[model samples]
Structure formats: structure tokens, C-alpha cells
Target chain A: MRAPALIVENLRLKLCADRGDTTLLSDVSFEIQSGEIFGLVGESGSGKTLTALAIMRLLPPTIKATGKVIFDGVDLLALPEYQMRSLRGNRIGMVFQEPVAALNPTFTIGTQLICAVRAHHKLSGHKARERAIELLDMVGIPEPRSRLGFYPHQFSGGMCQRVMIAMALAGDARLLLADEPTTSLDVTTQDEIVRLLERLSKDHGISVLFISHDLGLVARLCHRIAVAYAGELVEVGHTDALLQTPLHPYTRGLVRCVPDLTQIGVLRGGIPGTPPMPGHWPGGCRFQQRCPLAGNGCDDAQVTSSLADRTVRCWKSAASVDTASIENTTSPTNGPKNLARNTTS
Target chain B: MAAASVSSIWSVVLHRLMAVIPTVLFGTILIFGLVQIIPGGAAEEAAGPEASAEAIAVLREEMGLNRPLHVQYLSWLGNAIRGDLGRSLTDRRNIAKAITERLPLTIELTVIALILSLLIGIPLGVLSAINRHNRIDAAVTSVSGLGLALPEFWLAMLAVNLFALKLGWFPATGVPSVELGWHEHIQSLVLPSLTLASGAAAAITRFTRSGMLEALSSSYIRTAWALGLSPAQIFFRFALKNALIPLVTVIGIITSSLFGGAVLVESVFVIPGLGTMLVTAVLQKDYPTVQSVALVLTVVFVMISLVVDIGCAVLDPRTRR
Candidate 1:
């Protein structure tokens, strides 16, 4: 396996408000290997984006992050702000959700790209312009030299996303924190962006922490998948293993919810109930309220236990060696009633 | 590409310039109609109460008031377009020549006042917005609030009383001719321009503060911060440019109002300006001079608004659409 490029250990984030402090993320630990695209899959408000922000130390003033985000053997949480600023675009780049809004409307694309290029490198203005054109071409923009003078409004949404990608890559960063980069794009553009990111990772050996709400897309792009429920990662494993037999009930619900092509004309199903809001999460297991196979044991504190190929955070999965039987009992045919009966007996 | 954009800007300028014709035409009719509705006829007013009926008839014929109202308006408009505003009834001086001399004074006063407003207001607003909700912000906000509430005429009178009458620092009346030297000329402008600028400065301060606050929270600003740009670059280059877009319109409105306020300000100071000329012309029933002055003021207002549109387009390309 490649060396871990980013290691986040026990990253806890809390929102300090006039009312009280609300824990937004708690005890979130994960490691991204070099050149790997690790998918962070969850519904909205599940702290997926917050995790990325916390790692980058970009949380707003009221939010407090306390944990060790170790990169290159140094704890980033303890780094001085000036040092962090230097590391931001030079070593780690970020791409935002809204492509068009992410660019300054008044500045030409060339000026913006040249600014990004000259930020980290000591290049002359002419050289920077050439580099910017090359970077635009690298991102597959047609007629890069001519399009440099165009403003953000002149470009379509997909083209704007490509420009945003080019700016992110202009810094020659090793790790990219992409937070729902394709969420605002159409399906065809989404596919193209996904493929572009895949090729970038393959060519440049850049590690990506791809955060999204679409399970099917994440499974398709990510080498490994971590499913977060509420504010905690409920299960994490290889993409194929997690897709085949999701050990945590929340992960299973996510996998089952992916829209199927053969099931056209049938109303696609979604996991019942919404994720709990920050500061209101139930004690013990956060997902017990929504889990189909939740039993009396789930009311106790959930523990992350390592299995042969993955880690499961459910008490039922940790206690049983026969995960296949547990999975079979929780199938749609058996449903929650049968699983609850089996757990009691 | 540069040529294309330049040509497009010229086309926009031409279109805007064309739109001004109907506005000016309407303004002329309105000015002519308004002076026509006054209590006494201009011919009788010009001839005086003791004048005989023959004298009034001769005056009416000479001034073209004996013709129908439309014929009188049309003839006046024709002469006005040819740069001849006719002779003033009271003094018999050429109205256009009188205007050329006085209009410069009013334009200078308004320009100085506008510059003072922008210089004083923009920095204070940026400071307040940067330190938002703090002691400094509250202090600036309250002070500008006080400035806005004070009437310009009262302020002008008070300034004249204190600075001119009591302090003996400035002369209260009569602008010095340029031949008197720049020092005395600028000294003469001090009290009147300050009074005219106070309210507009306050208004600009409020608008700039709100606009800067809105721009500071925009998504592009967040992206700039994430890009690791310096604080100076972020605030000055990114935030200020966006903030200036909305402030341009506010500045335009303040400029037009400054011209309006100059009338009161000029009267209080007894300065030789278009405003003073307008007030005297109205009182003496000088309809030719009144129509020309009012038309000039309207055209100025329309042109200022046109500049505001082009300024916004230049600052924000999205508005160009």
C-alpha cells in the first residue's frame, strides 16, 4: 500500500453559539493514502463537508476544531496560521460546489489563472500567462489562448467547473479537497468531471477526498468508501465489499437507495427518516432511530470493531461472526420485524 | 476581441446618447409649461403694474407671447437648440452669455462637494465595515446619522455664522474671480461646499458600508480566501471592486441631489451661479432664462444617471448583459 498522505485522527468539531456548544463532528478518524480517491458519502448535514473544512482549518470563527490532522509528519492543527496559509494552495488545493460563483465575476479567466500560478511560483508575468494557458489546455478547455480573456459569465457551467479545476491544479498540489464538485452539473458533465478527476489522480498521483451525497457515484469513483451517519462514520471498507454486504444497517440503507435502471417506473426508495441535527443526536448509536435492524443492544454505545476486510460500527455486526446471516435476515423480504424477532430470540 | 468590446461600448454610448433626446424634449415642454402657468403673464410682469396697455401689447408682441402657446414654445425651442437663449427681460443681457459665466461656478462647487463626499465617506465606510459591530463602527454610524439628519440650509447658515462671521477664517459671500488667485478662490468655496457635501457624505457612507458588508460575505470572497491570497489583496482587490458596483449608483444619486442643493446653498452664500441666476430669473419673470437654466439642470441629471449605468457595467460585467 502507498504511504498515507493525510491522516485525520479523532477530529472533533463543535459550533460555539450564544445558546450552547453543539458537537458537529465527533471522533472522526480516517486516513487517505497517496494517489487514492476516498469517497465520503452521506446525506446533507451529516458533517461530510465539515470534515473536509476541519482538515483544511477553514472553519468559520464560531466553529472550534480540536483534533490531530497530521500531514507530512506535522500536526496541522497546531501549525501557526501563517504556516497554514503557505501550505494551503501550495500543498493542498480545494474545489468548491458552485463553479460559476466560485470565480470572481469581474476578472478575466487568464488574470485569475495567472494570479494563481504566480502565487506559489516566482515566475515572470509572461511565463505565468503561458503556464496558465498550458494549465487550461491540460483541463481540456478548447482554444486555451483565446478563451483566456473571457469572463466567468461567458463560460457554461461545465466549462466553469473545468476552470475551477484548472485553478485548483495550478498550485501543483498533492492533495485535493473536492466538496461536491459535480453536484451543480448535469449528468453528462458529471460523468466528464468524474473521468477528469480519475485521470488527474492517475497521472499526477494526487490524493482526493471526494465528498458527495450520491452513493452510486461515490462507489463508482472511489477506491474505498466511508459511509457517515449523522456525524460519525458508521462503516468503512473496500468499495466492492461495502456494496456487496454492508455490515452497518445505515450503510445497507444507503446502498439499497441507489437508483436502479431495471427498476424504471417503480418509485425509487429512500432511507426512512432524516439524519438528526447537530446537538440533538441520540445517545449511544446515532443511527439507532433510523436503522432497520436496531435492537436493544444498539441502545448501548456503538464500538468500531475491525473485521477481516473492513470496520463496522454496529454492536450486532461486532458480536456476530455470521454477517451473511445477519444480512439475509435484514433483507427486504424479511424486513425489520423479522430482524427484531431474531435479535430477541 | 479588444476591438469588439470597444465597438460594443461605443454602441452602448450612442444608444444612451440617443435616449437623452426625448428626455430633453420633454423637459423643455415641461419647463415652458410650468413658467406659463404662473399668476401673471410674463409680458405684464416685465412691463410692470404702472405700465400702459400699449406698453404691455408691445412687450407681448416683442416677446412672442401674442402668438399661440405652442408657437411660442416651438420658437423658443428652435432658438434654444441654436445656442441662443434670447435676452433676459429684466436686464436685457444675452441669456446664453450670462449662463456661460455663472454655470461654471455651480459646476465647480458641485464637483468639489462630490469629491469631498467620496473622499471622506468611502474611507469611513470601509473602516466601519471592516470593524463591523465594534466601537469604531458604532461611532462612525452614529456620527453619519447625525450628519444626515441636519438640514443643509441650516448647516450652511451655521457654518457661515461661525466660520465667516465669528472665526474670521473664511469670507461668507461672493466667490472670487480666478484672477484673484487659487488661494482666495478655494477659500471662498470652503463654507458653501462643506455644507452642500455633509448630507451626501453621510448618505454615501451608509451605502458604502452596506455594500462592503454584502461583498465581504460573497462566495467569491470565500474562494479568494481559500486560494491563500493575502488579506490586503482580498480586501482591496476582490472585496472593494465588488463593493464599488452598488456604490456607483448611490454616488450618482448623491451627485444629482448635490446639484439641487446647490441652489439653496448658492442663495445662502450669495454666490454667482446658475442656481442664483435661476432664482433671480424666476422672480423677475425671465422665462427665457428660467427655461434654459431648468433645461440645463435636467440634462445634467440625465447625463449623470447615464454615467452611473456605464460605470456599473464597467465594474460588473454581469450588468453588461
Candidate 2:
């Protein structure tokens, strides 16, 4: 085993306001190994984006973060904002979710790219321009030299996504945080972006912390996936193992919610009920309200439980999936589809 | 690409210039018609009531009052186009010459006021927006509110009383001639410009604050922040450019209004600019002087508006179309 690129140890964030201090991320913990594509998967308002923002130290002033965020053996949380700023865009880069608004509308693509590069490195103007062109080309843009003068709005949505990727990679960071990078894109662009990101990570040997609500995309791209629910990391395991036997009830719920490509004609059902609001979480397992296997035992507090090279945060995991096998196993098509998507991309 | 952009810019500039013509023409007719409707026509006002009917007839004939209003307008418009605004009825001085003499001082006052307003307004506005709901924001708001509430003439008089009469830091009234050198000229402009610019500055501060607030909250700004560019870079480079687009339009309106605003401000400060000249000519019912000054100011406003439109297009590429 190698040192992880990032280790988020019991990270927590609370929004401090005059009315009351609301804990947003309550004891979140995860790690991304060097060169690994780690998926931080969750639904909306589950504090997935907040965790990414906390790692970047880009959270709002009202939102206070605590606990360790060690990147490559260095404690990030302990760094002053000045030092943290140097790490940002230098050792760590981020691609925001909305491609269109991610760029300064008034500035040309080349200017922004060059700025992002030069902000970290002491490159001369000529060298910075060259770097910008190379970055753009790396992101699969055509005629990179000519496209330099074009503004953000001049580019199509897909093209803008490429430009944003170019900018994020401009600093040559070791870890990349992509916050739902493909959510705003069309399906074809989303597919292309997924492939691009995977290829880049492989080629550069850079770690990617991909935050997304789309399970299919996450399943396709990430080697290891962490399921988050209501500010809690409910499950973490290798992709195939987790899919074959989703240890946590929430993970099981997510696995079943994925439409079986084999049974397309059959109606698909979603996990009922929303994740509880951060502060208003249930007294026991956060997912118990929506877990089908809920029992008196489920009412007990759920904590991380290690079982066979996987971490599951559910009280009834052994009985639910370990013995009977995953409910999603009926689809022989499921495993291959995810594998195929990943390989092709 | 360079050639194409240059050509496109030409087209935009030409389009803006073409737009100026109708605006100036419409403005002239409106000003002329409004002045004619001021109870007594210029000819009658020039010829006192005690003057005999035959004397009044001759005065009216000399002033071309007997002609149809449209014909008179066309002739006056033609003279104006040819740079011959006839001569002032009261003093027989060339109306154009009188305007040209006062033009430089008025322009100087306006420019100073504009620069001062922008210098004070933009930073304060950006700061207020950045620190919204804080003490600095509250103070800025209150000061701007005070500026907006006070009348320009009252402000001018008050400024003179405080800064000039009491402090003895400036001349009490009237702008020095250009021959006095740039220093003296600038010195004379301070009080008048302050009085004229404060109201517009107050408004600009509000517009800038609101525009900056909107830009600062935009997703691009958030992206900039996330990219780890310092807060200053995100604000000055990213947000300020977007914020200035709308502020440019507001400034254009403000600049155009300053020409008309000079009338009261000049009177209060006793500056012998076009505004005060126009006031004196109006009181004496100098027909040519009044008509020509009004026409000149209208054209100036149209020209300024065109420039501002182009500036907006430059600042915000999306507005080019």
C-alpha cells in the first residue's frame, strides 16, 4: 500500500449563525490513494460539495471546518490561509460543476488559462502561452492556438467544459477535485468528459476526488467508491466488491435504484424519502428511515464496521447482503456494463 | 480574425454614430418648441410691452418671427449646421463665439466633476457591496443618501459658505480664465465641480454598490475564489469588469445630464461657462444665443451617449450586437 494523496480524517463543518450553529458535515472521513479515482457519491444536499469545498478551504466564512485534512502527509487544516492558497491551484486543483459560469465571461479562454498557470508558476509570458495551448490540446480542443482569443460564451457548452478542464489541469496539481463536473452537460458530453478525466488521471498519475450524484457515472469512473448520506460516509469499498455485495443498506438502496439495463421494460423504483436535514438526522442510522431492512436493531447508532476488505455503516449488513447475496445480482448485465463503461472511457 | 474584428468594430461605431443624428434632431426640436411655449415668445420678450406696435413689428421682422415656425426652425437649423448661429439680439456678439469662449471652462468643470465622482464612488461602492450590512456599508449608504437629498444649488451654496467663505481655502466665486494657467483654472473649478458632481457621485455609488454586489455573487467569482486567486484578484479583475458594464451606462446618463446641470451649478458658483451665458441670454431674451446654446448642448449629449454605448460594447462583448 502507498501513501494516499488525501486523507480526510473525521472532518466536520458547522455553519455558525446568530440563530444557531448548524453542524453540516458531521465526522466525515475518507481517503484517496495515490493515482486513484475515488468517488465521493451522494445525492443533493448530502454535503458532498461541502466536503470538497472544505478540502479546498474554500468554504464560506460562516461555515467553520475542523479535523484533519492531510494531503501527501502534510496537514492541510493546520496551514494558514496564505499557505493554503499556495497549495490550491499548485498541489490541488478543482473543476467547478457549472462549466458556463466557471469561467470569467469577460476574459478570453487563453487569458484565464494563462492566468491560472502563471498564478502558480513564474513562467514568462511566452512560456505561459505555450503551456496554455498545450493544456487546451490536452483537454481535446482543436486548433488550440486559434481558440485562445475566444471568450467563454463563444464556446459551446461541451467546449466550455473542455476549457474548464484545461484550466483546472493548468497548474499541474497532484489532486483534482471535480465537483459534479458532468452534471450540467449533455449525455454525450458527459460520456466524453468521463473518458477524458479517466485518461488524464491515468496519464498523469494524479488522484481524482470525483463528487457526483450520478451513481452510474461514479460506478464507471471510480476504482473505489464512498457512499455519503446526510453528512456521513456510510460505506467505502472497491467498486466490484461493493456492487456485488453492497454492505450498507443505503448502498443497497443506491445499487437497486440504478435501472437494470437488462430489464429496461420494467418500471424502476427510487429510494423513497429524502436524506434527513444535516442537524435533524435520526437518532440512529441516518438511512434507517429509507432502509427496507429496518428493525429494532437499526434504531441503534450506526458506525463504521469493517468486513472483508470493505467498510459498511449499517447495523444489519451481515444478514441483509453477506448471507443472501446482493439483491442486484439478478442482473448479470450490471457488473459488465460498469466495467465496460470504465474501460472504454 | 484581426481584420474581421476591426471591420465589425467599424460597423458598430458607424451604427452608433448614425443613431446620434435622430437623437440630436429630436432633442433640438423639443428644446426649441419648449422655449417658444414659455408664455412669451423670444421676439415679444426681447421687445418690451411699452414699445410701439410698429417698433415691435420691426423687431419681430428682424428676428424672423413673422415666418412660419417650421420655416424659422429650418433656417435656424441651417445656420446652426453651417456654424453661423447669427448674432445675439441683445449685444450683437456672435452667438457661436460666445459659446466657444465659455465651452472650455464648462468642459473642464464637467470633466473634473466626472473624474472626482468616479474616483470616490467606485471604490466606496465596491467596498460597501463587499461589506454589505457592516458599519462601513451603513456609513456609505447614509452619506450617499445625504448627497441625494440635498439640492444641487443648496449644496453649492452650502459648500461655498463652508469651504470658501468660512475656511478661506478657495475663491468665493467665478472660474479663472484659461490665460491664468492650468493651476489657477483647476483651482477655480474645485468648488463648482464639487457642487455639480456630488449628486451624480451619490447615485453612482449606489449603482456601483448594487452592480458590484451582483458580480461578486456570480458563479464565475466563486470559481475564481476556488481557484485560489487572492480575494483582490477575484474582485478587481473578475468582478469589476462585469460590474462596470452597467455602471458605464449609468455614468453616460449622468455625464449627459451634467451639461444641463451646469445651469444651476454655474449660477451658484458664478462661473462664466455656457450654462451661465445661457442664463444671462435667456433673461435678456437673446434669441440666437438661447437657441444656439440649447442646440449645442443637445448635440453634445447625443455625442456623449454614443461614446458611452460604444464603451459599454467594449467593456461587455455580449452587448456588441
Candidate 3:
């Protein structure tokens, strides 16, 4: 896939302290093909956000990361801070979670966008401002010129998210990392943002690393899905294949938890037990404690293997499943019952 | 567009003016009432014990000291509106003339002190914030703590002992005369200004450090850093201005506190300013001189607060709405 646009090789991040360290992300690796939306789905504290932060080199002073983040043949981790800064908004951009609080309250939308444009390029203020207006218009903001003078507080949540998207596209960034971009918006706004992002990705051919806990939304927007469970990637595959036949038990549970509108009189479900904290990860498979199909062999670290464009990190996936029984029993209407039985047993 | 911005500025100014008027009026009334309640009278001070009883009565009548308190207060207010502050009891000079002569020196000293505070305080604050929990921050915090501990008068005395007595770098007392050039006058003003500034500078540094720390951790700052803005740009363009909103509030309070600080610093430095004049007026129970000076000071304090409110509105556009 033309060098996969961006690649991470065995990334490990540790939260450092004066006394000791705690591992946040371990042996995490992934690659993004050009013009593809890759979903990293996990709940909060599952190291999904940490992985994005490590890729962007935006980790706090206390975080120590070890990995090779190769983007467009350049090793991002090895680059000097100054050069990395120049590459950030120019080649790679980020849309953070909260649209309302993400923007600087003191600056107008135009001023901030202009600053973003001028940060990477040596453009005149007038030129940058013109580009800002154009970018705002491109993001579907109505009357961009008139709204240029309005502060972030004047904009609604959806409008602010659009402004954030405009800022991300200000310098024609090649890769966009949207970190839970729609988590703070209304359901309708969430749908609008996802649609807009999909259209932008297709039109510009920009690769996006879309991070969210909402598997359903990820299923719609992303071409590939990487389900993260307790800081470990348990499954990675095409969105359709992964949803149709989730090999990893964690991925199966996540898929089952998605509320199906077609199945009436069905209760929505959630993953049983919270993910383990950073310092207290279980040995071997990180999701073993919570996996319904966990066996004695599951305690041994199993190597990830790929078959027909799908990769699963599980010991039981190697053995064949009774496809008929698995399919017939695992109806959307019976998802909650299965989840409840699994948790009890 | 320019007209709109100007009107916005005016709107802020008007709002601030409205807030300050009552405070100023309240201060004036309190000061006037306090002077009236004090033992002895201006007439007694003007006419000595050796003077005839008839002469004392005449002086008291002329000054309206025998009138009811409310009547005296109203008469004084009416005269003040017309720019008549009556005559000083001791020197027989027009109270307004005396105040005007002293006002320049006090304002000059205050301005110098404020400049010193900003010059030293801001850098110290920035440095402390940048190196939070490190040796630099610790040192700055300790120095500021010490500055706060030492009273203005004691600092002035220490400066006099070190610079004037020990180093022989400056004169021990008195202000430079009008014959001296502005530069020479400024040199004479420096020591007193720095002494007066120490406490304010320390307070400002502490406030600024906390403010900058808070601003640096904000989401916008993180976004700015992620946008690949240079540390300099992030610090100055994003963090510093955001920090200044809180710092400016501290500065406003400190500037008003300067009047109280000036009472001691001005006396210790022995400069011919309002502090010295107020002291003399108080000792002689010179009601007109005391009331006029107090009224002027209250007006200045209110005016400063008004400017600060306007500055806040301009700095933070959300306040305008």
C-alpha cells in the first residue's frame, strides 16, 4: 500500500516518575494506508489516546515513549523537536475531543486559523487571513467572512467543531488524528461530523486515525477497525469482516454491545468489568481476565497471526468454531442474555 | 469598523466609571467625617493660645466650625465643586495650590515604583513558571516571601543604610530641586522608588507565576504547542496574554495599595509628596487640607480601578458582550 503512509513498529510508552515508571501502552503496532480511515476503538484509559499522543510527540514531560513512528519515510521520533514542530500542522494535524474548550477563548476563529496557517508557512498576514476564510468556507461554516471576527464562545458546539476541522485542514495536512472528535457533541452533530470527515477524507485522500469508544460510529466511518482492550490490540480487520465475524472474544463482546435498531425488544449491552489500570495489567493476554472464552492456554502469550486480511490475537481462534451454532445463538436480540450469562459464569 | 471598536472601548469605560463613582463618594464622606470627629479644630490650630478669645471666635465663625456638622459638610462640598479648598491653617497657602505642588512628586514616585515592579516582577514570574518546582522557582518564591515580610518603611531604611550611608551612592534625604535636569531628578528618585516597589514587585511575581502556571496547563496552550508553534510563540502569544488577565487584576489591587504604602515610603524617603503633606495636615488638625488631599487620593484610586476594569474588557472580548 505504497509504504502505508504511516507505520508504528512495537511502540511502548511509560509514564515516568522520580521513583518508578508505569507502562501505559506496550508492544502496540499499527499502519495506516493512504486515504484510509483507521479506527482505534477503546474506552477511556485503554491507552488509545496515549497512542495518538505518542504518534504526535505531544506526550507530557512525564511520559517516556520508545518506538519508530515512520511517516512519509521520515522517522518522527528521531527528528529534533524544532523539525517535528514544523512538520506537525503542515503534514499532520489533530482534532481534539472537546470542541468548546479546545479553542482559545480570547482569539476569534479567523485569528486562530490564520495563526495555524502562518505557523507552518511564511505567509503574509493578509494571505493567511484569506486562506483562513477559504478554509472556514470549505468546512461548511456559513458566512465565513462575517463570522471571522466572532470569538469561540459565540459559536455553538457544532460550529466550534467545524472550526476545529477547519484549523486541522489549514495547512493542507496529509494525516489527521481525530481523538474522540465527536464525543462532546450531540448525536445529530456527531452524525454530521462523521459524514463531513468521511467526505473530506475521500476528497482530499488524507489518511485519518479516528479514535473513539463508539464502535457503531467507527464502523460507519472507518475502513479498518483495530479494537483495543486494556491497552492491547486484540483484533484488526476490514470493518465489514470484523463486524460479521469478530475472532477475538473482546471484539465479539464489543460488537454485541452495539445496539441494533433492527432488533426490537432487545436490550443494549456493555462490556463486563472496567479495564485494568496502567500499573495493574494482567500477565500474558491483557484481555484474558474479561474474555468469556478464556481457557488455561489463554494465560500463555499468543502470537498474532493474519489470514485473508484479518488478524486476531487469541489462542482459541486457531481452532475452528461451530459456525452454525455461533451464528444462530448470537442474535442481536439475545446479545444481552449472552453477555449476562458470560459475566455470571 | 474603527468607530465600532471605539464605541466598544467607550462602553467599557462608561461601565467602569459607573462602578467607581459610589466607591469614590463613600471614601470622600468617610474621610470628611473622620476629620470632623478628630479632637481639636482647625481654627484652634490657626489661632494660638496667646491670641484673644474674641479672635478665636472670629476665626471659628469664618471657617464655619460653629455650624452643624451636615451644614459644614455641605458648605465644604459646595466650595470643593467650585475648586475652592480654603486656606491651609499653618502656611496660609491655598490648599489646592499646596496639593497640586505635592501631587506631581507623589505621582512620579508611584509611576517609577510601578515600572520597577513590572520590569522585575514579570521576568521573575515567567522564569518561575517555566521552571516550576525547580531551583529557580524556589529561589524566586523565597525572595518574594522575604519582600512581603519586610515592611515598606523598613525596606526604605535598609536601602538608605546600604546605598546612602554605606555605599554613598545617593543622597540620604530630600528630593532633587527643579534646577536639576530630568535625568538627575530620576537618579535621585530611583532608590525610594525601588524601596516602595519591593513589596508590590514580590506580590506581582507570585501572582504572575501562579497565573502563568494555570495558563500553561490550559487546553488552548496544549493545542498551540501541538500546532507546532515554537515555545517562544506559545509562551508569549498564547500563555502570557492569557496569564496577564489575572496578573492585571493583581496589579490593579497593588496599584491602589500603593497609596497606603506611599504613606510610609514617602515619609522615610522624605520626598515633598502627599504623604508628608497629609502628615503635617493631620498633626495641625487642618480639616480643609486633610479633606482635600483625602478626596483627591480617593478619586485617583477610583480612577485607577476604572482603568483596570476597562483594560479587562478590552483584553477579554467576552466581557464586552
Candidate 4:
């Protein structure tokens, strides 16, 4: 009976840059259920950050967006910016990757955290300050009351991220948009932050639209994951199903690129050519030029067909030949330990 | 670490103030030596043309111009230390008395010019930085460009023509007498102050625009926008504070230059400020008046630099350590 926390349907964006008008997000559609973590996986220049910005309506002046970004049954695109301002950092929170930079350097953690709290709430300054301490404690920061006065420079990388998490939780937000929250931290710090974010999402019953380029980390944390290539969604399904049985060639290429410890002396295979330029992309299949097994009909009308529980966008993907060898050979290798190495690689 | 506590800041300020002693000594010597080397005798100017050569020689000895250069300098420096710059050679009026009388008027003009430049320059910068390529931004840049192109003297003439002779809104040239009301004094300063502020305001505008642009694009500003702070709060609280740090240095430089700039503007308006006094003294070879004005300007300029440095440390916590 309840609507999903966020549903983005046919959300497209184009950048009117100095070069020309180019599509940044082509018909990107997905939905995140409440209390679930959905992953958006992509390589750099794949429009992952752009899609996140589109959800929050934070795109730059050079970019334009159209279609529906429905949140809790309200079409966000239709809401005025005055209304949107209240919704942002209130019902929907955001945690950017560079935790130190994401906070104002001049402001103390307490001041910044309290500002986020009081932005939407009508609490007294004292009450807001108390709430800021509480939020810091909730994010596992030690001695919250004393540490509140410290600036961003005083906190370690991991502690800074914990502060960012506290900031995201300030308004009791229902949906959190995390844009590569761990990309700037080290492997150890990244692991701690990932666990903290996952735990907070569960404890708070908040849905997260997690965006990252690390397939290994996404597989470990997400319930459902979608793969984006060259500003286009190529595959979508359950994390286990999509990675284990990749229906699209681009998805298969990404899966195979994850280093497999079982196959020694093999340094991982990369997708042959670079992701296509925006305005210069050939018509038909956007991936056809990169797809090795491209046949005559591969250049024909590229369609997204639902295969059991997964969606694949390709003409030849419907009658996919044997790719069991890819699944069998490509792995997290030694499971979780090797997965961390794949991220660094 | 630039993180400064109260005691540390006081110590730093104290240290900077002590350095002013040597600077004053060196600057006074330089000014006195340069004035002495000029190709004319103060005795000729002090005495009338019809006076005998014997009268001029007596005047030179009485004025201490006939003494050895070092002996003259020592006596002058000793008298200067006692707050007595002696008497002007040409007018025989006490130089210190003349300075005190004109000091307030010059201070008032420079302060008004300073306030005008900051008011016009900073906001125009913020507007242009935010609007970027819009019509208002283009207009602001072009206006500042015009301010840069037209020297203060030329601008002063045009202002006198437009607002004084043509419109008769302000007095074209004059300072208010002491008995005049405050508004009369302010009204007289309008054209003169505008002329003095134009060039300095142009420099301030350029610095403010670039500083504001940099601050606006910084990560913290994006964070503020992402956090949904109102545009006003984001600008006044976050972006403006960071933008103003660099502007403090610009202000210090401008303020010092404005002090020097007041000289010409004073001459133009015939206000009898220290600038006019210095010009008259230099033309008539009155050593005491020129040397005293130069020393005072130097000391004041250095003091302003100190204040600006301390102001910056206060505004930005990172610089304090």
C-alpha cells in the first residue's frame, strides 16, 4: 500500500557544453524500496554522479533534465524549488565522497551538524546543539560532546566520514543519496565507513541510493544493483543474479575485469576501447562498437528485454550464448579479502 | 600552526609595532637628505627678492640653513623627537600647528573615500561574480574598467564640471570653515572623496570579484547548497567570509595608497590638507614641512599595514597559528 521511497522513471539529462549538446543520462530508470540499499554501478564518465545530481535537482546550469523523479509519490520535477529546498536535507539526505571537503572548513562540526538539524526543524539552539551531539554519538563518534567543537582538520579521514554520516542523519531523512562515500578514504577506512553506512541504513530504516564505480563493494552492500555504461543503463537485477549471470556484454566485461585470484598470471581483461564520446556515439547499440561478439543484428534496434528477474539492453543478449566460463573463472577470488584488493586495483 | 591564542596575537602585534621605530628613523633621514640635495636654497625663498644679500645670509643662519648638513639634521631630529618640527622657512608659521589643523580634514576625506570604495567595490564584485556573464555583471566590469582608465585628476575635473558648474549641486572647490555645520562639511567632501576613491575602488572591485568567484566554487559552498541553506545565508555566512580573507590584504594596500593619493586630490580641491602643504613646502624649499609630512605618512602607512594583518588573523582562524 505504501509507495517506494524513490522511483526514477525514464529520467534523462543532456549537457549543453561548449562542444555541443550531449546526452548525459539516457532513459535511466530505477526504483528503491524503503529500508533497501540500491547500488548504481558505473565506471568514470558513465554519468553516475550526474544521475545522483539529477535526483536531487542539483545539476549545473549547463545541464538539463526531463521526466519523472518521483519520491514518496511526489513528482520532484513538478515541485517548486522552495519546496524542494525543504525536502533536501530533510526527507532526502546526501553524503558526498570527499568527507572533509563536504563540510565547511571554517565551521566547527557542532555548528555544521546543528545547522543541518535546525534547517528543517523549529528547535531552540540548545535543543539543536543537544541533537547534534546525539547524532554524532549515533554515528559511533567517541566523546561527542567534547569533540563537537573540533573543526574538520582535527578529525581523521574515518572520523570525518562518521561526521558526514551524522550530518546525513540530522533530519531523520527517509532516503539517503550517497555518491561514492568511500572513494576518497583508504581501504581500511573505506571498510569501516561502508559498514557504518550499511548499519545506519538498517537501524534508521532509510533507503539509500548508493553510487559507486567499485563493483566489488557494490556487490557486498547492495540488495539490487544496476550497471551503467556510457550514460546508458545496460543491466539491472539483484546483486547476486546480475554479477553471477551477467546478461549484457558490458556487464560481463565489468564482471570479468574484477581480478580473480584463482587464475594466477592473468592480470584481468579490460573493455577493449574507451567509453564512447557523448555527441559522437554511433546510432543503434551504444555498446556495439565495444562488444566483441557484435553480429549483423547487433547494430539494429537496441532493446531492453526482461529476462526472468534481470533486464538486459541488447539485441543479441536475448539469445545469449554460453558465458558460464566467465562466471566460473571470474570471482571475488578468496571471497571478501580478495574483494578489497579488486577495489584498490 | 597558524592557530593563534590571545597572548600569541598580542605578542605578534607587539613585535610588529616595535619594528616601526627603525622604519621611522630611516624614512625621516631619507626624506631630509633628498630635500637638502635639491638645487635651491631655502634662504632665497624665505627672504623677499628686494632684501639685501646680507639679509638673506642672516636669514639662512637664523633658519639653521647656514650650518653643516649633519648639524642641521641633528638639531631637526632632536626637535622632531620633542614633537616640535620648528617653523616653516617661508611662512614662519609653526609646522606642527599647521599639520594639526589640516590633519582632521585630510583624515575625514580619506575615511570617506575608503568607506565609499568598500561599499561600491565589494557588493559590485559579489554581484558580478554571481551573475558572471549577465548584463549587470558586464555593466559592473565595464564601469570598473572606466574607473581604472580615467585618472583621479581627470575624473575630478569631469565631476566638478557635471555636478558643480552644470548642476551647482556641490561647491566646485573649497573646505568648510570650522563654524559650519556637519552636513556642510560632508557636502563639500562629496566630489573630492569620489575623485579620491575611484581608482582604489577599481582595484578593490577586481580583487573582490576574483576572490568571490573562487570562494563560490569552493567545495564548502557546494556543501552549503547541498545542505539546503538559503541563498542569503550561504552567501553572507559562508562564501563572503572566505572571500573577505584575501580582500583584507587588498584593503590594506588600498588604504596605504589612498593616504598617498589624498595629496593630489587635496591640491585639486584646494582644501589645504597636508597634501597641499607638502606641495607648497616642496616648491618653496621649506625642509621642515615636507619632512614632517613624509614621516607622518610613512608611520601611518606602516600602522595601517599592521592593523590589516591583525584583522586578517582575526577573520580567518587558519591564519592565526
TM-score of each: 0.95, 0.93, 0.94, 0.88
lDDT of 4: 0.83
User: In candidate 2, what are the lDDT values of residues B135-248, reduced to their tens digit?
Assistant: 999999999998788899998898899999999888889877767787877887899898888988899999999999999888788777666787788878889999999999
Better lDDT candidate (1, 4): 1
Model 4 alpha-carbon miss at residue A151, Å: 3.0
Q: List the residue pairs that clash in candidate 1.
A: none
- Chain A TM-scores for all candidates read 0.94, 0.91, 0.93, 0.90
Candidates sorted by TM-score, descending order? 1, 3, 2, 4
Tell me the spans in candidate 3 whose CA falls farther than 4 Å from its real position: A263-265, A318-338, A341-345, B1-6, B41-59
- The candidate that wins on TM-score is 1
Model 1: per-residue Cα lDDT over B125-171, one tens digit each: 98899889899999999999988999999999999999999999999
Name the lDDT value of residue A65 in candidate 2.
90
Clash count for each candidate, listed in order shown? 0, 0, 0, 4
Residue pairs with backbone atoms closer than 3 Å in model 4 (clashes) = B1-B321, B2-B320, B2-B321, B3-B321
Inter-residue clash pairs, candidate 2: none
Relative to the unseen true structure, what is the C-alpha lDDT of residue A4 in candidate 4, on a scale of 0 to 100? 80
Interface RMSD of each: 1.2, 1.4, 1.7, 3.2
Scored against the true structure, residue B267 in model 4 reaches a CA lDDT of 85
Q: What is the C-alpha lDDT of each candidate?
A: 0.87, 0.84, 0.84, 0.83
What tens-digit string does per-residue lDDT give for candidate 2 at A1-345? 878899999999999999999989888888899999999888998999999999999887899999999996888988999988888887898988879888888888888889888888899999999999999999999999999988888898889988988877777689999999999999999999999999999999989999999888999999999998998888899988887767776776688678788987864555666788977988878887776666797777776766666777876665543565546543424433443343345
Query: Against the true structure, what is model 3's DockQ?
Result: 0.61
